[model samples]
Target: MHLLRPLPQYLVSRYHGWVATSYAENSAWYRRLADDGQRPRAMVISCCDSRVHVTSIFGADSGEFFIHRNIANLVPPYAPDGLQHGTSAAVEYAVTALKVAHLIVVGHTSCGGVAGCHAMCSGQAPELEEKSSFVGRWMDILRPGYERVKDLPADQQVAALEREAVLVSIENLMGFPFVKAAVEGEQLSLHGLVHDIRAGTLEQAEDGGRRWTRV
Candidate 1:
């Protein structure tokens, strides 16, 4: 606690403004949410990138989507090693307890994490090769993805890898027993999407991620 610092002025001011405006305007709705708890329709696994706004993209209200974010938006294969797995824990809660109807894995264009994975795998980023580099180890989850697209032209590799992140995550999500059971029971559905930042386009994966179509 001693390491914690006071909130910056700008954030404090913005929060106060929200309280005075949005919060005050929807106080009743907020109270209802607190009283009833959350019942989100979907679980969105997205990147930690600040540019990717899950709610804004779908025009969703608060409490409508259960969101979990990590580097590259990657979901590691289901490993029941009794270790700390934040993403797995979130997925378990969302699927088993909350019973969300949809599990969506979203990636985006120009993703730094995806680019780092591309660099690390192509022998271009030695610094990431170190065992101590957390980002490097996390990006290893996407090495199979890099291998799948390594033969492509250099300019096309990163974008392809970004989509691979989404595909790989969707595949891994099925590895979770609860997730699999939910899907088999017709209680859950999986989806993959990619956002093209420059073009303001969102694409959905189709035919088992072999092709993409505009959303």
Candidate 2:
């Protein structure tokens, strides 16, 4: 908390400027949104990395997408424990309450989470048990993906691993009964997208022989 004081003031000032402009440009809509409720068409699961912003990437308005961000943008398989699960809860709310029509999992290149997973798998980083850190635990979700494509060339391996993680999250989405029902009923569509930050392009995972291609 002590480390964030300086930045918080700057951010608050910037946000005030944005708020002033937003009220001026869309005062009526803003008032209605504040009084009424949000009805987003899609829900996007994205990384919490400062560089990856779903709203900016999609050019969406405030209530366009119900967004959930986490380390590496992971979605664990549905579980009904007493523990609070942020990503799963968001998914539930988006699909059940908001009734969003689409759920998009966005994975970006050069993700620290992915790199950490790679490092752990390669024994470059300390073992999970030894570290006992949040990142280490969070990255456990991507272990299967890391193992699946560990044999490829360094560059290709990272891309494959990242894509694999995206697919895994999509599979995890299916673990939720509501998500499954929505998709099966043709009310919801699930998409896995990979964003090449350096290239400033998006790649949609495809079926058959073809793989990630620019969108």
Candidate 3:
């Protein structure tokens, strides 16, 4: 806490403004949510990109979607090593506790994390391969995805990997015992999507992942 810096006064004021206006207008719903607890129907795993607003894109309100974010929105295969796993923990809670019916992985264009992984896998980013590189190790989950796209040109490879990231997450999500069970029982459905930043378009992958169609 000592190392933390105070947030800007402008942002603090803006938050207070929203609390007084939007929060006040929706006070009843807010109180109901707080009292009854959240039972979101869907879980969205997305990148920690400021540009990609999951709720805004989905027209979702509070208590509608359980959202978890991480670099490149990648999900690692279930290891269950009795170690701390933030993403996996979120997925477990969403599926078991929240009982979310849909689990969606959202990838995006112009993703810095994906680009970095592409660079690292292509041997263009030696720094990320260092033993002390936490990000590098975290991104190792996507190495299999990189292998699928490694043969393409640099530009195409980045895009391919970006799309592949979504597929990889879907594949990894099945690695979770609970997720796999829910999915097999038809209680949970898995989805993959990509957001085009410049075009402001959203695309959903076909059932077979053969193509992406605008949604």
Candidate 4:
């Protein structure tokens, strides 16, 4: 296609380096994964931030987790209106097809997506309010979360909203009929976590997102 171009040289070099080292050492493992197909134990819904590395944080190897990344790591309430739903599709496949035991919604500190939602909600960013802005529309999923933390101090609102994003996503995920059934049947478990990027710490929500504990 005219719109597609060759990969950048840096990325090409990185790919070759990986193939020579990591991939070379794990060739047999890769072959086994390819032959048997992926059997990930958990599905992580994480932010698109480059700083957030789920595998590195968990010390997981390839094929160990089925990961999906999106702005703010937000999942919308179940709405099967016959429209394309990338996040929903990933969740469906992860739960029904892969049968992942855990579905984790991971949020991070100082997330740009969360900031954008904060700005949009506070009427500070008019550009994001446009209907044509994909990032803005996707971030609308976190509006309810923003409402909960809006009353906090100005300096603390963004950070609070970041954790709220994870909680909101976990709540929306259960709105899916299959997800509810899976939980009720004891086939799946849900987790909400927020990562402190600078501190390299993680906190998990307990008691249905009402309390947080270090994990």
TM-score of each: 0.97, 0.91, 0.96, 0.96
Extract clashing residue pairs from model 3: none
lDDT of 3: 0.95
TM-score for candidate 3, please give it: 0.96
Q: Count clashing residue pairs per candidate.
A: 0, 0, 0, 0
Clashing pairs in 4: none
Which wins on lDDT, candidate 2 or candidate 3?
3
- For 1-215, candidate 2 gives per-residue lDDT tens digits of 55554567789898889878976888888778788999899999999889997798889987889999998889998888988898999999999999999999999999988888888887888865365687888888888888888888877887787787788898889999999999999999998998888888898878821477778
Best-first order by TM-score: 1, 3, 4, 2
The alpha-carbon deviation from the true structure for residue 78 of candidate 2, after best TM-score superposition, in angstroms, is 1.6
TM-score of 1: 0.97
lDDT of 1 by residue, 97-202 (tens): 9999999999999999999999999999999999999999999999989999999998999999999999999989999999999999999999999998889899
Per-candidate Cα RMSD to the true structure, in Å, reads 1.1, 2.4, 1.3, 1.2
lDDT of 3 by residue, 1-215 (tens): 58889999999999999999989999999999999999999999999999999999999999999999999999999998999999999999999999999999999999999999999998999999998998899889999999989888866999999999999999999999999999999999999999999999999989657899999
Instruction: Write model 4 residue lDDT over 6-88, tens digit each, in one string.
Output: 99999999999999999999999999999999999999999999999999999999999999999989999999999999999
